[model samples]
Target: MNKNRVRLRCTYHGCELKQTGGIPYLAPYFDPLLQLLNIEVLDSSNHWKLFSKHALVHYGKQFARLGKLKRNDVIELTAQLRKDGSFVYPAHVRLLTNGPRREKIPESRTELIGYVMTQNGLYHLGGKYEYPHYVNQYENWLNKKDSTADQSKAESSSITPNQSYCHHHYGTHGNEKKGEK
Candidate 1:
């Protein structure tokens, strides 16, 4: 019942979540909530330029989906807590341009440029090619994903490149030797 956190109980299957001191269950919805709060605060300050920067960086896909850019833009994001405790964040992001940089950006290139959101607000994060800190968090996330994939691949395969291939290589399969077949 904290004033800052949005709490909703799941009605699906009568699932009751324990008070674990942290809402890890709601981690997926944190970005949406942050977006909502950011928009509200930005609108209050009437800073569409800053908002454009924010969208370009954090919402690359949503911004690319915009198709075109204008001098001013608005992106609608829904942060709904369902009765069953499920969270959905449907977004409608429209890119607005300023300073004569309006143009269609390739989806691959969109993520290359942008800003970083902090407690103070959005600031220029630069492109990935320039500063590592600009996309440090993102790069770390990608690395984490790759490592997990490698771990899974390693678990599924017993053979390693450093290991010498024996005569039973082609015949052996599923942890058994081909001669056994």
Candidate 2:
């Protein structure tokens, strides 16, 4: 297998399109137009009969990535295998234009679902949310979560033990030190 070479196959479920002997071509890369043709091969419906650029969608049980692929980038398409012997090729590029901005959600919410690239946009079957890019979403979610935790720590550290005690025991109007008579 060529290191730079990649296979382009549409393993979508219930898709009528199939290649003879299931032979897949190992291409160096798949451009926008070729990706569109791949979608046509996978889906038999008219949903993608007319479209502009298609996005290579990576579908995973807990994550996904979707976006415009570069001409030289080594691409790998993957999806969860089904028991019915039909491949769940969620990684196929679909007839999707600039759909929605890809954003990351909590990790707990990402489980048990697969990413889907459709004519409408990218969707998570497990959740109601839509994700355009999977890799970026995971990274952004981690960064956002980390920043939030750091902010919480900073807020907590700003208050000293003495300050807390004084604020809780004494009102703003009675902050003066008590002197024994």
Candidate 3:
């Protein structure tokens, strides 16, 4: 065990984790650990912030031990839910070539990686918004277009056509006689 390697214990009660490698399996409800460790919640909107920060430090030390992961080296992340709703043994560990990091980690060591742990009360290993269904839903919303009235209203509000132009083009109120001088 390297001096800098920080061992991550199970946040769940009564679970003794002797080995420390891979990502730290965190529970959806991590406030208890934060309270126990007195880790301040920097942003209430991002729940996983604190845990992610700790994971990087823990993993960094592990990386140093394994001789710094090459650019394309595989890094796997596995997490399981214990009986008490916290992460259990995180046993299904595997390795794959470089994975995606849509939201890149910042240079600052204190930054937290925000992610949703559970959806509708089930423990899912994939981080929040990783499913195709959710991605499709977001795509639908992105592709949706405003109604005609909404478009007209926005156009009218932004650019008021000159009265003279309107009269010359369509005439006022459609009441102009065809031959009126």
Q: What range of 10 consecutive residues in model 1 has the weakest lDDT sum?
A: 8-17
Model 1's alpha-carbon lDDT is 0.34
lDDT of 1 by residue, 2-111 (tens): 22223221101110112224344332111211122223212324443222212212334555455433323443443343344333443444333325444333243212
Clashes of each: 5, 3, 0
- List candidate 1 stretches off by more than 4 Å: 1-57, 67-72, 80-88, 94-102, 109-111, 114-181
How would the candidate models be sorted by lDDT, starting from the highest? 2, 1, 3
lDDT, candidate 3, 22-125, per-residue tens: 33443221110111121112233534333331221232222222221333343332343233323323333233444453222122111111111121222334
Rank all candidate structures by their TM-score, best first, as comma-separated numbers.
2, 1, 3
Best by TM-score: 2
Candidate 1 lDDT for residue 107 = 43
Candidate 2 lDDT at 153 equals 93
- Write one digit per residue (lDDT tens) for candidate 2, span 1-181: 2333223333222101112232244211111112222222212341422121243332332222434232333333434433343333444433233345544433332221211123223343564433334434545656776899899898778765545645544542233465621
Q: What value does the lDDT take at residue 68 in candidate 3?
A: 18
lDDT of 2 at 134: 40
TM-score for candidate 1, please give it.
Answer: 0.23
